[model samples]
Target: MADIEVFVFAVEAELEAMDRERVGVHRRGRKPDLALRRRLVGLVWTLTFGGMQWRVAGWLSGIPFTTLHSAFARWARLGLWRRLGQRLALDWRLACGDEVLPSAVVVDSRSLRSAPSAWARGIDGGKLIKGVKALAVCDKHGSLLDLELYPANTDDRAGALPLLSRLAALGFQGDLLGDSGFKGAPFATAALAHDIHVSVSPGGTRDGCFLPSGIRWVVERLFAWLSRYRRLNIVYDRAPDLFAAHIWIAMISIISRRLVAQTHT
Candidate 1:
C-alpha cells in the first residue's frame, strides 16, 4: 500500500483546485481544531485499508467518531471523492506518458450481494444474487474513469445508459468495448449520438469461459482490483452515493500509489 500521506496530499490539492468552499471551509464558524490534512489522511486510511467501523477508525486516529463521520459524509455529498479520483487518474496517466484524455474506454459491471439491511438492492437473475450492480468505465490501462451503482435487476443496457450519458456529457468521443450484455441496436444508436462506437466482445465457450479479448479485459481487471478493498467486496452502504464514493476512494488510493511510484522512478 502507498503511504496515506500521498493520498491526503493529492486530495488536498484537488480540493484546493476545485475550490475549498465546497467542503464548507468558508463557512462561518470557529473552524475545526484538527488540521484538514490529518482528518483527510485518517479518512482515506479508514476507507482504503481499515474495514472497521467509523467509531473504531476515529478511536485509532485520535479524532472524535462523530467528527470523522460528519466530515466524510460532507465530502461524499460534495462528490469530492469522485473529483479527487479523476484528478489523480489524469495525473498518473500524464506522468506515465499517456494521453490526458482516453480515446477508448472499457465498460463492465459486477453484481455484489448486499447486506440484509441495505435499501437499494435487487435480484440479479443472471448472477442470482440479491444486491446492486456496479458499472464502471476504465481506460486501456485499467484506470477508473466513471462508475454507477444501480439495482441488480437493471439490465446491462439500461444500467449502462447513465454511465454512457456521463461519458458523453464529459465530451468523451471514442470507442467503448463491452460484453455481450451491452450488444443491441438501442445501445449502438445511443452511443452513436456521442460519436462513440460500441463494440461488444464475442460470446463465451460452452464451458462458460470467455475467449480472450484484449481491450475488454481491462475493465475486469479493475473489478478485481476493487474487490481487494473489503469495503467494496460487499455492499454495506445504505445509500448508492456513499457506495460510489467508496469506490472512488479505492481508485484514488490505487492511482495515487501509481503516481507516487512514477515520481520515484
Candidate 2:
C-alpha cells in the first residue's frame, strides 16, 4: 500500500477544485489552514487501514485525539467522504475510458465481526458472524458506485432494498447481478420496482467445486480489495455510516494511487 501522505497530496488539487458545497450550516469556527487541512484529511487516510481507536490513530498520525475524531465525524455527517468517493470513482472510470454512467452494476455483501463496543450488529446465521453487513455496489471494473452498511443479520434480499433506492437516486437503471442468495421473487420484485433488473448466478456448488460466476464475481473481488484494509477486516465503528465513510476513504485512496500512477506513466 502507498503511504497516506502521498495519496493525500495526490488528491489535494482535486479536493481544492471540487466545490465544498457544504450542506446546511454557516460555520462558527474559522477555516483550517492548508497544513491543518492536509493533516485532518491525512488522518482520514490513517483511519482507512488502522484500528478504529481515534486515540491510537491520533498518536500515530501526530494529531490530537479529539481533533481528529471530531473532524472525521463532522466530515461523515456532512457527506464529504461520500461525494469525494463518487467523484473519484467517476474520474477513475473516465481515465480508463469507460462510460460516465454504468448501464449494469454488480452487488454483493460481506459480514465482518464487530467489536464489543459496537452497538449496531446482528448475527449472520450462514456466516455465523455477529457484526455488520457491507453492501458494495460496483461497476464491472470493480470501482464502487455506492456502499451500504447495516446489521449483519439482514439477508441479501432484504438488505438490497436501501441499496436499490440509493442506486436509483444515482440514476442507475440496468442489470443488478448477484449470487443465488439474491435469487427469489421478493428481491426481483424489489429490484424491478427501482427499474433495475435482477440477474442471479447459479445456485450451489457444482460437484462440490467452486466456480466463479461471470461478472457477478467482480463484487467478490471488490470485497477482497476492501479486506486489505485492517480496520475494514473487523467492524469497530459505532455507527454504520462511519464504517461506510472509512470504506469511501479506502476506495479514494486506491483511486488516487491509480490516477497518480497513470499520470506518471
Candidate 3:
C-alpha cells in the first residue's frame, strides 16, 4: 500500500473506534474512491510539506487543482480531519501515563497570509498579525490538546477560551501559560472552572513578571512542529474549511510521528 493508504488506514481504524459522529457520506459511498483518497492525501501532504498553491498541488498529484481543492474543503467540513486529531490526542494520552497530569500546558497563536478574495474579508480576512492565525494548545510533553484558526484580525483572547474549555473537557487541567495577549477575565474564568491557573509572559508589566512565560515556549514548539509542513506555513486554502483541514492534518501528522518516537524510545 502507498503511504497515504497507510495513513488513511491508521486514521480510519482509530476514528471508526473512537469518533462519536460519522462523516457525511458521499453519494459515491462512505469510503472515498481509493484513487481519490490517494490524491487527497497527496494534496494534503504536499500542502503540509510543500506549502504550494492548489495549482501546484494539482501538478504534483496529477489531479485538477479544483478537484484537489474541493476534496480538501469537503473532508474538512465533514470533520474527518478533526476526528483524526482527536484520535491522535487520545493515542498520546494512552501512551503516556493517564494519571500523570502535565506540569504545564502552553498556549499561543501565529498568523499566515490567506487568499486575497472577497470571501476572505471581515473576520474571514485574517487580521494584521502578519497572516491567519492558528491558536494552539499543547502540553509540556509536546502533545497537542486543541487548536483553533481565525482570521488574523481575530484577537487571540477572543478564541483561546473555547479551545481551553474543550481541553478541560478532555481532562487537561494544569497551569496554563500564554503570552501577554491572553491576559483577561474571560481566560481567568475559563481556567478557574477547570481548576487551571493562568500564567502570561510580561512584556514590561508587574503581572508579566509573575506570569510563567518561560513555560509558554512549549506551545511555540508545538506550532513549529505544525509549520514543518509547508502547506500550513502559508494559508493557501481558498475556504476556511480547507485552511482548517491543513492545520488539523498537520496536527495529526505531528502526533502520529510523536507516537512513533515514543515507541522507539
Candidate 4:
C-alpha cells in the first residue's frame, strides 16, 4: 500500500472538490485537525479490511470511539459518498479515456444482498428480501464512467436511464449495449435523442449478438474492486447516505491506486 499521508492528501483534495460541488462551499472546516483525519483514515482502513469495531478503530487511532462514530455519521449525512463516487468515476475517465464518447459503451446492473438493518417493509408489499441494485457504465479498462444505486427492489431498467443521463452530462455520446432487461423503448429513444445507438440482446437467442462484452466487463470489474473493502460489502450503516460515503471512500482508494499506476506507466 502507498503512504497513508499520500492517500490522505489525495482524499483531502477529492473531499474539497466534492464539498464545492455538493455544498457550494470549498472550506476545509478548520483544517480537519490533521491528527483527526489521520485517525479517521486509519479507522476507515480497518473497517475496509474487515477489522474490529469502531472502538477498535478508536484504540488504534488513539481517539475516543464516540468521536470517530460521530464524525463518520456526520460526513455520511453530508453526501460524501456520492461525491466520492462522482470523483472516482471522473478520475477514471480522465486517466483511462471515456469509452462512451465516439465508441461503444457497456451498461449493466448488479444485485447485492442487503444487511438486516437495511430491510424495508411496505404496508401491502409485505416483508420482502432487502437488497440494492447498482447500475454502472464503464470503459474497456474497468474505469467507471457512470453509476447509480437504488433500493434492491427497484427495477434495474428504471435505473438505467439515470446512468445514461449521467453519461450524457459528462459529454458521452455514442453507442450503448445492454442485456434484454433493457428492452423498453424509453432508454433506446433517450439515447437516440443524443445520437447514441442502442444494442440489446434479443430474447431466446443466446448465441449471437453484437456483444460489447469486453467493454461491459469493465463496470463489473470496478464492482469487484469495490468489494475488496468490507464496509462496502454490506450496508452496515442504517442511513443510505452514510453507506454511500463508505462507497465513495472505497472508490477514492481504487482511483488512487489507478493514478499511481498511470504515473509509473
Candidate 5:
C-alpha cells in the first residue's frame, strides 16, 4: 500500500479507538459515510502537503469552503494535531520496544524563510534567514516529543523551555541533549526547573560535522524528515499555530507508515 494509504488507515484506527466526542466527529445531520470521511481525511492531507491555501480545500473536496477550512483550523485550535502526534509517538515507541516517556530528548531549531503572507517574520543573524524558527524536541529514536514555532530572532534556549515543560507536565524526566547553542548555565538552570537535566553535545563543530556519542544527531534526522514535506519547507500560513499543526501532521504521516511497516517486517 502507498504510505498515505497506510497513514489514512492508521488515522482511521485511531479515530475508532477514540470516543466520538474526543475525535470531534459528530453523527448529527447528513454525516459523510466511511468512504467519504476517509476521502475527507485524505483531502486534509492533500491540502497540508500541497500548501496551496485553506480556501482551496472546499474546491478540492467539493465540501463547502468555509466548512472545510473551519474544521481544519478548528482541529488545530483544539489541539487535535498535537494529541495525535503524542499518541503516535507512544505507539511508535511501543512498536519498537521502547518506553512511552522518552528517557532522553534531543532539541533543536530550524529557520525557514517566511512568505510575504506570513506573519511575525524575523531575521536569524546566526543562520542568516529571514523567517521564523521551529523548535523541535524528539526522543532518541527520532519520534517527535514536542514542538514550538516562533520568530527566528528568539533565542533557542528561551524558545525551548515551554516545549520541555509540556513534556515534563506529561511526567517526562530525562536528559535534554542539544548542540552547543543550548550550553549556557542559564538554559541548564531553566531546564532543571522542569526536572529535565541538560547535556550539551561537546564543543564547537568548527573542526567538522560534530558527530555526537549518542542520539543528538537523531533529531537532525527528524528535522530532515520534516523538510521533505513540501508544505513545511517555507512558512506560508499567516498563523504560526497552523504551520506548527502541519508539522505534527507530517510526523503522523511518517510515523504511521513506520508502524505499518513494522507489522510486515
Candidate 6:
C-alpha cells in the first residue's frame, strides 16, 4: 500500500468521527470520495515532510494540482487541521503521562520574509525584516497550543492578546512566560483578567553577550521545530489563514511522530 494509504488507515476511525461531527445536519450533495480523500491526505504529508510546493507535490503524488489545492483549502476552512493538531497534542501529553491540559505555556513570535507579491506584509523593526510575524503559544513541553499570524510591524502585545484570549476562552488558566517584548502594564492586566499570570524575563544578555534563558526557550525551540518544514521557513501563502493552517499541520505531524515513538519505547 502507498504511504498515504497506510496513514489514512491508521487514523481511519478518527477521521470518520471528525467527518461525522463536522458535516452535521447540513449534509448535501454527494458523499466525499474516499479515494480522493486518501490522496489529499497523502499530499498533506508530502507537503509537510518533503516541503514540496503544491505543483511539485501534485506531480509526485500523481494527483492534479488543482484538485489538491481545492481539497486542502476546503479542509482548512472546515478547521480540520486545527482539530487534528489539538487531538494529537492531547495524545502526546497522555503518552508522556502528563495532564491533557497544560499548567503553563510559553509564548513567542518569529518574523519571516514574505514573497514580494504576498499580501499583508509588514516590517519587523526588531528583526529588521519586511514580512509577517507568527505568534505561537506552546505548552511546557513545546507542543503548540495556538498560533496567530499578523503583519511583522504589529506590536508584540497587540498580536499576543488575541491568542491569550482564545486560550482563556478554552478554559486555560496558568502562568505565561514571554520575552521582554511582552512587558507592559496593559498586557499584564489583560492576562490577569483571564486568570493567567504573566511574567516577562529580562533580555538574555550578560555583559552584552546573548544567552538563552530557561522558561522562554521552549517557545523559541518551538519556532526552531517549525523551521524544519521548508514551507514554513518563509511566508508564501497570500492568505494569512492558509498560512496558519500550515502551521497547525506542521505541529500535527511533529506531535504524531512523538506519540508513536513513545508508544513503542
Number of the predicted model whose TM-score against the real structure is largest: 1
lDDT of each: 0.80, 0.80, 0.68, 0.64, 0.81, 0.79
> What TM-score would each prediction reach against the true structure?
0.91, 0.90, 0.76, 0.75, 0.90, 0.90
Could you say which candidate leads in lDDT?
5
The per-prediction tally of clashing pairs is: 0, 0, 14, 3, 0, 0
Query: For model 6, how does the per-residue alpha-carbon lDDT over 150-220 read when each residue is reduced to its tens digit?
Result: 99999989999888778987678998888888999999999999999988886568575545676778887
Q: Write the per-residue lDDT of candidate 3 for residues 50-89, one digit (tens) a residue.
A: 6777787788667888887776776677677877777677
What's the lDDT of the predicted structure labeled candidate 2?
A: 0.80
Per-residue error for 237 in candidate 5, Å, reads 1.1
Better structure of 1 and 5 per TM-score:
1
Q: Which wins on lDDT, candidate 5 or candidate 6?
A: 5
Query: How displaced is residue 185 in candidate 6, in Å?
Result: 0.5
Give the per-residue lDDT digits (tens) of candidate 5, residues 45-76: 77667776666778766787676666567768
Q: Write the per-residue lDDT of candidate 2 for residues 48-148, one digit (tens) a residue.
A: 77655788877877789888888778767877678777887888889989887788898888898998877587999977899888889999889898987
C-alpha lDDT of residue 64 in model 2: 92
Candidate 5 lDDT score relative to the true structure:
0.81
Model 3's number of clashes is 14
